[model samples]
Target: MFGVLGPNGAGKSTVLRILMGLWHAQAGSVTFQGARLPPPYDALRAQAGVVFQRATLDDLLTARENLLASGRLYGVRGPRLNERVTELLKVAGLVDRADERVVTWSGGMKRRLELMRALLHRPKLLLMDEPTSGLDEAAFRTFWVQVSRLRMQEGLSVLVSTHRPDEAQKCDRLTVLDEGKQLVTNTTAVLSRYVGGDVVTLEVESPDVTAAVLRASLKVDARVVDNTVRIEHPEGHALIPRVFEALDRGTVKGVTLRPPSLADVFFHLTGRALSSRVSNEPEPMTIRTEGQP
Candidate 1:
């Protein structure tokens, strides 16, 4: 699956909406398959399924009923519709709750039902916009497990838009977007490689003193936060002994070394923390209208 990852107001939802023909881009065209997409592109719409951040199922309908309705909307009926509904229930692990009303289901269950409903038509492309929001760790794991299985089994082409780094890393490839502009597209490993090598985190009794001493002694850019000092270096392991020796008389506690992650890649690109930004501002609203797919 491909990913569109960036902070809020980065136009991820706008891009998806434009692709779905729900919103028009003034200066660009959306091409599907091998031809330019037609206005009110019914063919393209029929060949795609989109899942928004919120659940789209009717609360009064049972999970099974919801799937059947979606199938019927896509012109599926009779034995074929029933078989597809049953298969989707099994795939989403919601077979036990198939007859239960959607209002009685948990948040994760609702998300799964929405996914199953999206798959009823068996479209060529699946677009998910922040599909894992508000889910707990366990629920997130289950969702990814199902998504991975679908990709491996059906070879579905998926394009997911998310601001979470962990979620972005799960995709086969990532397309980083910022304020309606494309930044980079690469694998997680390749992006992490840009951050150089291992990161060294030193917990010192006095961060200011340790940072000063390290700067004077070593040729590295050390940033101190509270009681810790973080440094990024090509030879982090080799510098550890020297750091300890420099802080021999000082009150140093411990040291930690870790490989680069998506967080680091983001920081390198944006000069800020993702969690910090997310906490300071409200997430952008993700709206999906009916009659599109």
Candidate 2:
């Protein structure tokens, strides 16, 4: 599975639409199974399924109804269609609510149903855009569990787009995009190796003072944001005693330190914090026109 990791307006969704043939790209061609995609793109689309960021199921329709409709659209029917729906229900853990209306389903359940709908055709490639956006911790765990199982059972080639660093870490590989351009694509391990250190966050009343002392004493990189002084050190823990000694003489408040995370990797590459940079505004999933560039 491939992943697109970027901020809200970084054009991840735009790329997905182009791949799906719902929109076209001006500068590049999309190939499927090693062939340049043709017009109409029906052949290419048949091999793919998409789950949008927002719920697409009919509110009045039951879970089973939604799946059956999707299967019908894919020309699946009779015992085979029923069997497939049943299997997907079990996979998504929605069997108990198979007859429940979508309007009554919880956010997680609706998301699962959408996933099941996308899988109804058993497409070779599955594209998901922010599939776990509004889910709680428990729901997120359940979603990933099902995803891992599906990947193994169906050998599905999955591509997911998300802004969450933790979610990006779970993917097999990641494509980090910024401002409509691909920055880097690699495994989590490879990216982490570049970090080569732990992250030290100091919650001090006077961040400027703490940053000054750390800069003078340690051969490290540091920055201040949100009243917190963040430092990157190869041996971050080893520097704690020295840091404490220095902060003790200043107007310090608190300190926190930890190993490098995906967030740190993002900051190191982008020169900005991921959480702080992404907009809180709800972004709509829309198609990008092709050949406009």
Candidate 3:
């Protein structure tokens, strides 16, 4: 799996739409299966399954009806289509609910049905845009479990765009985008190492003041983000006690020490939190392309 990681207005949806040929790109070429694609991207669209950021299922349609509609678009029909739909519904654990309208289902169930619909034609590639946008922990885990199972069973090459760190971490490689610009592209492990150390965060009464105090007194590069005083250092284990000693009584409400994560890498590269929103419109085809296994 490969990931395009960024927050809102970072062009995740726009990029996916362009790649799927649902939206036109001002420039750039796309090569699929060793052949360069022409305008309209009919070939790419035909071979890849897509799940947009927004739900596209006709809520009034039955779960089975939705999958049947998608299968028809992909030219799967007769016994083959029936067998495929039945198999996918079973995989999604919605065989009993297949005849029910999608509007009556939970968000997670609808998302699962969407996935089943995407895979009904057995496409070579899967493109998902924020597949777990509003799902709870249980729902998110269940959804990804189905994805992992299907990928392994089908040997599919997947491309996903999401701001969720947990989702991005599942990818074999990632491209971090900020304001539509590719800030970095690498494997998640290599990208996480760019932070160079552990992250020590202090939930304090006054984040700015605490950050400034740590910078001046401890001589550490402390930054305030999301109302927390965060200090990134090579030896966080040794720095923790010193940090506590430096702070005044009752100033800190909580402290957390952990290894560097994707969020830390984003902060190191962009000087801002991954959750921070950017308003810039994406330049067409600004993506730095890479191979997907």
Measured against the true structure, the TM-scores of the candidates, in listed sequence, are: 0.83, 0.89, 0.92
Candidates ranked by lDDT, best first? 3, 2, 1
Candidate achieving higher TM-score, 2 or 3 = 3
The TM-score measured for candidate 3 stands at 0.92
lDDT of 2 by residue, 1-293 (tens): 78898888888998888777778677777778888776546777787878888898999989999999999988989999999999999989889889988897888888888888988989999999988887877777788888888888888999999998878888888888888988888987787766768888887877887788778876557688656888888888887777877666655556788888777787788877766633333554556699763
* Each prediction's whole-model lDDT (CA): 0.81, 0.82, 0.89
Between prediction 1 and prediction 2, the one with superior lDDT is: 2
Clashing pairs in 3: none
| Better-scoring candidate (TM-score), 1 or 3 | 3
Candidate 3: which stretches are off by over 4 Å? 276-293
Judge candidate 3 at residue 65 and give its lDDT. Answer: 94
TM-score computed on alpha carbons, candidate 1: 0.83
Please give, for residues 3-101, the per-residue lDDT of candidate 3 as tens digits: 999878888887898888888878788888999988778898999998876678999999999999999999999999999999999999999999998
Winning model by lDDT: 3
State how far residue 96 of model 1 sits from its true place (Å).
Answer: 2.0
Pairwise lDDT winner, candidates 1 and 3: 3
